[model samples]
Target: MMMITTGRMLRCVSLVSMVIFAVLVNECSSQHTVWDPVHASIKNDIAQGVELNAWCKSKNTDFGHHRIAYGDEFVWTFKINFWNTTLYWCKMWWTDVDGKYTEGSYAIYKAERDWDECQNECHYSVRRDGIYQNNYASDVSDLVYPWPK
Candidate 1:
């Protein structure tokens, strides 16, 4: 009778330990699966044709220099999985009809709790006069570059 009771106690202890381990694992794994969507829209208004390029980056990772055309709109979506109080940015550059180049960018610093408040979409309009229609909260004065200049 003593041996049977000892065996039952060990089994119960093992079961409880397994349950605790499972809960810890679940919590850790769920944190990494939390991701938010970011949308970007670029509209080109430069005449005589132009090459529009844009990209997004977080930490040490970056995406691309996606190319679009004059009078065209390009839309992109990104799934951001990590945030260390670092800002995520999307930058744009273009070569205009006269071979002049212009650039602009937008960035957002999103906190974990603000994930649901993330901007569903951001719009940027690239024009020969300069970058226009910026929707970012940051100051974009540095992004303006008149094509003739």
Candidate 2:
């Protein structure tokens, strides 16, 4: 058996320790804001503080847990309910990064309801007063742009 040199062993330990330290630092330093803050801001910009509960949680997600996140786990599911009547699947969307605004996913069915009502229930609003800014996208058949492409 070959003898293990003290220096070699120390170097190995140091490398392992450094790796662990780096990992810990990364884990602690990785901070991500939930997509809600961005979405909420959009609604606020348009509606001036009007928002939906789901939207609010999405933008302000603590990722820390408590009432909304609850131990860093998401407590809410993404969905749209019109006065708890119709559950639409398609809606315009924007992101938290640079406020990149965009329409909803055409692949999904968007929920429908008045923007003011959605803001009232969820406590949110958009920048303008129209179908798109009304908390519900007007065009239900399409998400991004109208069809006929």
Candidate 2 local lDDT, 16-135, one digit each (tens): 999999987966764321221212222223222223122222222322312221112112344333243323222334332345344332222123433322322222222223222223
Give Cα distance to truth, residue 63, candidate 1, Å: 1.9
Worst 10 residues of 1 by lDDT: 139-148
Cα lDDT tens digits for candidate 1, 33-122: 334465656677767467778776666657677777877877766665554354556687777667767776656334352243334444
Instruction: Output the TM-score of candidate 1.
Output: 0.46
**Which residue pairs show collisions in model 1?**
none
